[model samples]
Target: MKKKWVHIIIISVVFLYLFLPLAATFLYSIAKEWHNTILPVSYTFSAYENLYTDPRFLQAVGRTLLISGITLVLSVVTMATATFVVFMYLPKMERVLQALVMIPFAVPGVVAAVGLIKVYSSGPIILSGTIWILIGAYYVLVLPYMYQGIRNNLRTIDAKRLMEAAEVLGASKIKGFAFVIMPNMVTGILLSALLSFSILIGEFVLANFLIGGYYETIQVYLMRRLNENGHLASSIVITYFLTVAAISWMMLRLGRRFGKTEEIKEKIS
Candidate 1:
């Protein structure tokens, strides 16, 4: 009972922490005018309407989708390869490999972007002022979250035991890993996709600095007009939220389809 109260209190605090900002944004989005008058006396969808009609918003949406799609594919590829190497092999260097995986998070985002920018310029890749740079930046930014999902899914499955069982039955490591382990990690993949999508669609700081006017990601576009246009900015926020909701819902569906029994039970209860 004591523990239950603690959990309840903690959950309450977290709920407030999350919902307050979202609620404030939603309320502000609808308000005609907001000031220090305790509350805005009226609300309207003018902001949302303006957002849809604006050419900038439409272009931003397209760019955001493009960037996010690229990011998702790269994140999935990187996470999948990392999981295979770290979980199935790397017996002697698992710790070292995992530490490397955490490098993206440990290094500051700005520092990493600057380093990458320098390397790309120096190397024969010649990826200056291109979508590739944005995609590469997304690859790193989304790594920590995607890694967590992959690593967690890895932890739940007894990779060694499964591999042993499969090898004895004449299956190759690639076949066994792909056919068996991949299915179990569906939730993880979905989670990684959701997070990667979110991060990519709304990434601003790196996109602004590294991407020199070739491909304007949504966040970058929004930031450009924010000082001059409140309605357009609000529209971007609302539209982004809708995108996030749709992606998250799809992930949840995929997760529940697999053996996410605990999540299902919670929903039912």
Candidate 2:
């Protein structure tokens, strides 16, 4: 039918729009020289090899992972505890907390970075150029995702009933949370952490403005090297995309396994 043809055309357009740039980047990453041609005349993996072997690039990657990991852990713990408390004992304050979390999204990154610099540059806590500032900024940036993901999952699993049941069986509140609620929230927590990690790893605006020379992340490194070699920059972009995709794929697999285990437990019960 004409409708079916239209649907196929639309789908093809969408796919091309999404992946054409990625295809070009991948091609450029491997191309020895690409000019005045539809495709490169020659290809090589030297760009990738060079990117991987570079000490500075490796150091930037390590630093990025370190900061992103710490930020995820800190954000997860803080958001989880706060979300639990707000949902359980202080449900009335949920609106206030939600509004607070939306602040990061409302404010521009540059404005936030400037605000942080002004507040921390000369205060008793001088954290403007430190990794600690990045951690704090990342924590705020990820708060909404972390809170929403865990809260939705907790609600989906009826965490309140689980907690109450555990407590009814003579377990203390902490014990109930540790043994009952935490297990159910593992998938949601991992999902949020992975999402936040992806965001933080690619973050450049705040990182560049706040702690550019003092601390460099993968994004900063990429920016610095972009002018040096187009092929190398393309390689970095391709590698970055692949790394994020791999981490996301692995986390999704783990999340599905946790979901299956939880479902089996429910069926057994």
Best model per lDDT: 2
Candidate 1 per-residue lDDT, tens place, 1-269, comes to 99999999999999999888777777777888888776677888988887778787688778878877878887788777876687678756667767766887788778877887888886779776887887877777787788777876676565567678888898998888878777767777787788678667666778887884667667777777667666556666767787878877877786666446445534645
- In terms of TM-score, the best-performing candidate is 2
Model 2 lDDT per residue over 168-247, tens place:
99999999999999988888898888888888887899899889878888889999998898899899889988988988
Give every collision pair in model 2: none
* RMSD (Å) of each candidate, 1 decimal: 4.9, 2.5
For all candidates in order, the CA lDDT equals 0.75, 0.89
Worst 10 residues of 2 by lDDT: 260-269
